[model samples]
Target: MKFSSIIYVLLVFSFLTMTALSIYYYLQIQQDKVKISQAVSSGTPLPDYHFALIGEELDHDYWRLVGKGAKQNETEYDVFVEYEGPERSNPEEQLKLLDKAIKKKVDGIIVQALNDEFTPLIDLAVGKGIPVITIDTDSPDSLRSAYIGTDNYAAGQLAGKALIEDTGGEAVVGIVTGRFNNTHHSLRVEGFRDVIEQEAGIDIVAIEESNIDRIGAEEKAHNMLTEHKEITALYGTSALDGTGISEAAESLDRQDLYVITFDTLEENLRLLEKGKVDALVEQQPWKMGHQSVKIMTDLINEKQVKKIHHTNSSIVRKQNLPYRQDLRGGRQ
Candidate 1:
């Protein structure tokens, strides 16, 4: 072919390829934006302070919302937030990230201390003059500056009460908790059991740990419901637990099964709307993130900082779906 003919053919091919790629992106995929960090270019002025905010599972929608909150006002506070975490829930991995942050000597850290093993590392960061703030989960014995996020015990009590009311004080409850070793989950279970035990009409038929994953939650919930056919309701004490339980219930064709779970994740809310999940424990992760940053800023500024701040939480049911638009957040 002549040079002009060849050039014309290549141009048409390139244009078609570009059009296909654009259509694929705009139609096939839903996109989301998350600020991972403020990259400081060489010779560029840095923010006044650097803060490392570590979370449980980076890909999880609830934690992503929490991270978003922490980074929302980064420019306003004049701080660079390095928000990061493992792709999945791994406490040991989170510990390693915290250690790395400490060695880097970031001005501050906001981390979810999942359990007792995290306490020592938390203290180590504090000893090195790095103000550490705990989020979501707390290391009670650690020398961290402040604690923020949900009051787990109270939230659990709320869940239990919500169940009792929904079930009319009579339910054979099967509990699907995040993890046995996770402190917040333990507290939530304890608080829930205390409230449930007080009511003679309700019985906790079985309890299982999900290891903070949907598959684990589903398998355990499915097994519990199958083995114990009398289980009238399920209480999931983690972000993804409700989704799993809902799936399990649907698979078993348990249309009358009542379900309550932690976090108002978008999927969970959708399940609530479909009547698969009866109630959701509302956690304002965005507020938790933003408020924790504000607290950390006060600490760095040498201003009076409160030792603890609990972000808002409530029990949400299908009746209130229209008013709870803020529950739609982060990548699912």
Candidate 2:
């Protein structure tokens, strides 16, 4: 009995020792990883800093511009940038792509923050020591390193101011937005309302949601005009909304109504030339893309970056339309 008890005690001691050694090695590995990350972030000359840009959709013209900007810096920054996103604008799919990027442990990430749904996921990436930058739109609640995009509220105010000026500050206006819950869209609507409502002569009689579809926006614009016959102007908050608004007003043979919108897409410019649309508030998407990568690289090198970086935009009207076209390479 004594001999058996001694053997059992020896075995128990052996097991405990092995467990302690395993835990110590695991902790040492974790500490090493953290040190490496810190070293890279501190500008300790590294060969490669892999960065990924995940956007709402893969095929959109705006996102394409963003990708172009991101790629332009690959040679200059000595980094690799991979662009990926859902085939369409689906937030859930966007989340999956973010997760994949996180799993791959990219050095940094630039994402289009479309909704609050991305907030927690962005936080997760930050927790994993991956720096995140929000582009175009923002995730205000997350620990993102920086935001590089247009001031949406200001853009909306520009739209309203253009309408008021075109109509002598007295016209019934209608509004069409991509989605009500979209942060940027809501901010734009608020800015427009704030400006338009300041003049009692300008009244917004109707507001509609288009889900960012050109056809749906056109139909909604047509219906809004029919329902509110007194409307003398329309504001579209999405890229497609401008063309839709112009088409709806022209279809009704009410070309007298003033129209304003966002972006300088080719379709919007055509309407501008025809005098169907009055003005377009152009967001600098290419700059947003380029700046996003620059800021992310800075963060990876343990450099300080502003939490918010607002790109410049301008109201493209008839006079400057041709100049803008030449600058954008005649592409929408």
Candidate 3:
């Protein structure tokens, strides 16, 4: 083939590729617009109150349980509940979804204010006369109508006490959490630190953030064990942390290391049954969802609701594992 012909063919191929890419992105934007339109449409059709629950990824087991509780009360309350959010803990994405819910003018919103940055958005929703409830995490500075979820500080205390008891109040501890800036995780860490530090013999050797990434948590756990050979206990502040810590502990043959974590995930429960995880701090996610809707409904009806509702948190160990029936959290 002639060199000029070859050059011309390459130019055509490049042009076509760029055109295809542009079209693909254009269609993606269009699709997102359609979804936003549908979300906003929920505001219409009077006589039906609409509520939006926006949080972490839809597939997350904890949020699934929350959604289940919300859905269960829909028929009883004569309201519509819609749940949607990014597939990961993205504050920016969460804010965008909140904006959509606000534009939709939904009667109420239940969200996770992962950090204080969400305060302004929550206030915006409240300023629009929409009741907002913070679940899983709370934003006190925001004008949210109610804060419903576990008392993270108390839950952290439970973790600390459990760890001290298991380790005989004398050991090196490592913590794996989702995000340092996360209000819930930070509070949990604070509670744990306060209680654990009270013991003169116990020491916190390392505290790392996994950012809720499974592999990252596992890698952090492994690194902690490698770096601090004296570490005798591990604590996971996020739901995903338990599984990752377990995997790392097993791979490194650190079964002697005591493991305690938050949440009641199936994987974590299995580890508990097998005596890998010493204890789990269980939060009532179902109650968080259920109460969020109820409180929002109360606010919409002009009925006063409590400013804060602290849900139940308990420690689950192997001995009382039979009562684990209620700890099953997920979508119905």
Candidate 4:
């Protein structure tokens, strides 16, 4: 063959090989782009549907915060959020709301599980193919999809540790919880007991249930303080009960008693500033609300999520109260 002809043939061969490789790479990139688009658009193969969120009490600040989070999710995800609950924390009323949600055929339901007695109703919702996620409180026996809230037991333990640290673990303590049978309250009591039991010289002399009513909590606190004069500390598990305890302590001039409570209501913050309550355990109610709706959205879409999602709780003492206010914007 001539040298020029040989060189021309080699050049043609190299050009064809490079063109083939380029086409192969382009097709591979196109396929990968399609796969990515499907993953982003389809989102876990679950049904696309609306959700209903039922709380024990919708009028309360905490539940309102939860509703706000759900509303934000609804706007962001283009899903409907039906938020309904009783004016007060009534188990029967909350159950009726749950029934209404089920009848409305929402894709998922979120509840606070007013009390453990709502398990049967929760099971019914699950039986109807509507996934239920409990927030704040839960009924363990219920057929719920998941629970998103703070670890009440651990919160109680944190309060206990704070108390022990403040009093050198030898103070006589009293407890004021919202409802005796409520899961959150019960778990907190258990956690407090566990911590106090492990410590030396710290004793929980009296445990009282306030039913989460301010008047009821006040009465209980008054009676308990009158009866247990040696009590050096008081721990209240609920927002209302915490305020009541603080008020009772202030009224009776029990400045010696160290008060540790939960939630950061406006009044609670005032109490903290006034040196009436030594510390408050703050939970991320806003995050709980946001996550609850997100979980419901995922569940409706058949997306797998963690069975239990826990948010952290922090001890807000007088020293750190200002910092906490800056972080959470001085609101509950």
- Give candidate 4's whole-model lDDT: 0.82
lDDT of each: 0.87, 0.84, 0.87, 0.82
Better of 1 and 4 by lDDT: 1
Hey, what RMSD does candidate 1 come out at? 12.3
lDDT of 2 by residue, 1-332 (tens): 69999999999999999897567556644764775688689986553787889977777777777888888877788777778887766777888778767877889999988889989989999999999999989887899988999889888888888888888989998999988988889989999999999998999999999887788899999999999999988899988888788888889999788888988766677888999888889887777777777788888888878999998777888999656655364222
Residue-wise lDDT of candidate 1 within 22-98, one digit each (tens)?
Answer: 66444422321122222333444567888999999999888888888888878889887889798999998898789
> TM-score rank, highest first?
1, 3, 2, 4
User: Model 1: what TM-score?
Assistant: 0.86
- In model 3, state the lDDT of residue 173: 93
The CA lDDT at 325 in model 1 is 71
Report the Cα lDDT for residue 243, model 3. Answer: 87
Runs of candidate 4 exceeding 4 Å displacement? 1-48, 326-332
Query: By lDDT, highest first, what's the ranking?
Result: 1, 3, 2, 4
Give the lDDT of residue 194 in candidate 2: 95
Query: Which regions of candidate 2 fall more than 4 Å away from where they truly are?
Result: 1-47, 330-332
Decide which is better by TM-score, 2 or 4. 2
Output the lDDT of residue 140, model 2.
Answer: 77
